[model samples]
Target: MTPIVVPVPGVFPYEQLGFTNCVRHGDVLYLSGVASLDAQGQVIGDDIDAQTVQTYENIGRILAAGGSSLDRILQMTSFVVDLGRNGGGYVATRARILKQPTYTSAVIGVSALMMTGLLVEVQCCAAVSN
Candidate 1:
């Protein structure tokens, strides 16, 4: 199968950041990390809950661009700068978004992300029915 590069508008400035949002090969989409950023690639918020929610929304949009959806996600990896402070809330928000607990996931703490005030960055792999 040919690999398709799915365009996710406002995900990031690819010309500057040099990262693709998601690449679909066959039914699986390998998604790159996404955060709560606006169309201009600027960090959107300071609150973790708001960032987490926006991150999921961005992920859902990217997945949809790749002929997939949130429910098709099989795995996810999250990086958080303030895990101790936002861990519980982030997970709770994620649980609300996914609406299920049957997916593989891993969370890692970090000193910082590429952008300031970016509390979390989430990446996932999903299946698409194309």
Candidate 2:
């Protein structure tokens, strides 16, 4: 099936950067790695916990725009900078936000991300409703 780009309002212009925020194909939604970026692509948070919250907020917006929700998430991969220091915070914050650990997920260590202050980037997939 053909993929359709999902339009998320108030998100940064990832299109100009040669990528889309989310796309739907058949019953599945694929999201690019979402960071705590504002409308201008500036990092929004100072630390891992705050950035993890903002990252999930961004993911929620994109998933909703694609006819999905965080509850429908099938899998997620989080790229984290400074895994030794920030990994626990990222996990704890994610647990608080999600409430249920229902989705398949992994957190990977990385040296850096797209932006200087970015501590986490979440790439996700979910089931879109018919």
Best-fitting candidate, scored by lDDT: 2
Question: What is every candidate's alpha-carbon RMSD to the true fold?
Answer: 1.4, 1.0
Worst 10 residues of 2 by lDDT: 61-70
| Candidate 1 colliding pairs | none
What TM-score goes with each of the models?
0.93, 0.96
Per-candidate local distance difference test: 0.86, 0.90
lDDT (10s digit) by residue, model 2, range 1-130: 8899888998886899898998888899999999999878888989998898888888988888888888889999999999999999999999989887778999999999987889999998999865
* Candidate 2 root-mean-square deviation in Å: 1.0
- Model 1 lDDT tens row, 23-99: 99988999888899987878887888899989998888888888889998999999998789888888888888989
lDDT of 2: 0.90
Candidate 1 Cα lDDT to native: 0.86
Regions of model 1 farther than 4 Å from truth: none
